[model samples]
Target: MDVFPLPLARIGIIGGGQLGRMMAKAAKRLGCTCVVLDPTPGSPASQVAGHQILGDYHDPSKLRELAEICDVITFDIEDIDTETLAQLEQEGHRFHPSPRVLALIQDKLTQKQAFAAAGIPTAPFVELSEPSPEAFAAFGYPLVQKARRGGYDGRGVSIVKTPEDYDAHLPVPSLLERFVPAAKELAVVVARARDGECRCYPVVEMCFRSGENVLDLLLAPANIPSSVAEAAVDLAVRTVEMLDGVGIFGVELFLTETGELLVNEVAPRTHNSGHHTIEANVTDQFEQHLRAVVGLPLGVTDQLSPAAMINLLGAPGRRGRPIIKGMAEALAIPGVCLHLYGKATSAPFRKMGHVTVLDPDIETAKRKAERVRDLIEISAEDHP
Candidate 1:
C-alpha cells in the first residue's frame, strides 16, 4: 500500500452506498483508511470502511462529527447538507469539489443555468416554477422534466411525449428541456487537481435502461470517429475547468444525429460512468479522486484495453435478502470481473453490482459482457 506522506491521511466519506464502498476499497490499497457516515448499519461502504458512524447524512450534528474525526471529507452521493459543509469549510475543514459546487449542482435548474452562463453547449431549457399541467402545456410537449433536487438512478425525471404525459410530470419545482434526438449518449470522466492540473478519460458511450434512465452499459473509447471523440474530450475537459473543482467529475453528454455534441449533466464526484476504470485504465477513478482530494499528484489515465461494463440490477418484483444466481457460470467466462456490492436486499431495478469485461477489441469485450450479463440473476431469497 502506498502511504500518503501528508497529514491528510484519515478520510471521511458521506453517504455510504456502493460508490463509497468502492472508494473505501481504493483507499485501503493506498495505505489510507476511511470513516463512513451513513444511517444504515452495515451499509455497503460501512462493510469495508475502517469505521462507521451511524447517522443520517442530512443531520448537521452527524456532518460535524464526521468532519471532526477525519482529516478531509468527501461524499458518494450529491444529496447532502451543503449549508453545514460550507460553514465547516469556512472553519478550515477540507471538502473537495467545494460546498459551493455541491450547492449549485444540488438543484438541476441551477446546474443547467450555470452551464449556459459558462457558454457550454447544452439543450435549451427553462425553469418551471409551477409544474402544473397548464404550465407544462405552455412549455410544449416532447420535453423532459427533471426535479430540482434529490434525484438519482432514473428517479425524479419524467419524459413527456404529449400533453397526456403531463399527468406523470414531476410536481416539484423542475425544468423543461427540449429533448434532443440523440444519436449516441456519451460520458467523459475528468479529474482535476487543486493546482489546476486536469486530465480526461477517453469519451465513452453510454446506453441507458429504457424508462429507468439508469446506465445500462458502457463502452470505453467510444466507437465514434476519431475527430468526434477528440472534440468530446476537449469539451469535457473545458467543462471541468469551468467548474474549477478539485476532484473527479463525470460529464454526461448528448451526440445528435447531425453530429452536434451537447452537455447533459455533470456529476461532481466519482460516478457510475467511470466504474469501468477499475480494471481498464492505468489509474482507477476512485484512487484518482483520493489523490486529487488529498493533494497528491494525479495519475495517468491511459486505457489498458478496450472494455465493456454492465450494471447488475436486482431481479424484478423481488424484495428480500439477495440470492445471487449464475455467478459460477458467469465467472467461467474469461476476462470477466464481477463486483457484488454487499447490499443485503434485492429490489426491482436496484443496482446490486456491476460486471466489467476487458479485451483487446471493444466489440469482443461487449459480446462477452452480454453473455455474462444474461448468465447471472440477482433475486430475493424470500420472495417468489
Candidate 2:
C-alpha cells in the first residue's frame, strides 16, 4: 500500500487537545509532520506537533492556511465549521473523514436522525427549543436533554427527572430522548482504512461517575456473555461502515436490562474509551488512526492483555495550575501506565489525564484501576 510517500506527508489537525496530542505522537512515529491549529498557545497537541498554527478553529483563513500545508487534514474535536472545510475540499484539500461527514454529525439531533436512517437502533428522541414543563411531558419523566450542538464530556446534557428540572435550566436548540435504562454502557473502537478495510477492538464496559455522565472507569473485554460482546462489536462496526470514513471511530453503546443493545453515540475520532488500547492492544488507537487516515494497512486489533482505564479529573475547589499528587504510589503498582495531558490549568471535571492498568484478567485489571484512581490526585494549585 502506497501511503503519501513517507517523510513528505504532513497531517493537519483542527483541535489541539489531548486526542490531537496523542495523534501527533503517532504521526511522529511514522515520520510525518503534524501541524496543529487551535487558539490556545502551547496547547496539548501544539506542544508536541511539528508546528503550530495559532488561530480560531472556525476561521476560514486559518483553515485555508492549514489545508495548504498538509497532505491530509483531520480533527481531534467534533465541533468545527464544515462550510469552510467543504470549500477547501472543493479546492483539492484532503480531509480524512471529509467535511460532509462532519456536516451530518455536528449536531446531536442530526446525528440521532442519521442513526435511524441507517437502520441503527437508538433511543427514542424528540427535538426541543424551549425548556418547558409541557415539553418534558411530551418525552416523559427521567428523559435526557442534550444540546443540539456544542457539548462534550458531561456538559450540555442533563437528566430531567421532573418537569421542574426543565424549568431549572435555560433551553437552547436541543433534543430530548427517552432515557434507556441501560444495564451497562458499552464502547468499541473501530478503524477504517481509506480503501475500506475495517477493524474493531473488543467491547468495553463503562462505569460513569455518580451525578455526572462522565466515564470513571472502563473495563475491556466486558465480563458478559461472549454472544453479547459479539453483538456489540457487530453493531459498532456497522455504524462505522455506514459513515464510511477513514480514521478511527468510537461507538458508544447501551446494553439494556432486557438484553438488547442500542447505539448511544458515535465519536468520529479516537476516543476516551480506547485509552486502554495504548497499553493493551497490538496497535493503539492513535497509531491505528494515523495508519488508516494516511492509507496504510489497518493494524491488528488483538489485545495483548486484559486492561482497565480510569480517567484523571481535576480535583474540585482547586482552581489554578495543575499539581499532581500520589504519583509514586500509583506507579508502584505492577503494569500501570499514566498519561498526562500537558494542560496549564485545571477545573472541576476537566480531563487532565488517564491511567491504564493491565492484568492477567479483566477483574484484576479493574480492581487495580480503582486503586490507581484513588492514588492519583489532580489537584488545582496556585500557579507558582
Candidate 2 residue pairs in clash (backbone atoms < 3 Å)? none
Candidate 1 TM-score versus the reference: 0.97
lDDT of 1 at 354: 99
Clashes of 2: 0
Model 1 lDDT, residue 150, Cα: 91
- Segments of candidate 2 deviating more than 4 angstroms: 1-5, 168-170
lDDT of 2 by residue, 1-384 (tens): 554555857999999999999999988988889999999999999989958999998999999999998999999998898999999999999998889878777788999998999999999998888767777887798898899888889878888777667664546888889888899999999999988888999999999998767999999888889999999989988998888888899999999999999998888899999999988999999999999888777889999999999999999788799989999999999989999999989988899999999999888889999999889999987888
**Cand. 1 Cα-lDDT:** 0.92
List the candidates' TM-scores in order. Answer: 0.97, 0.97
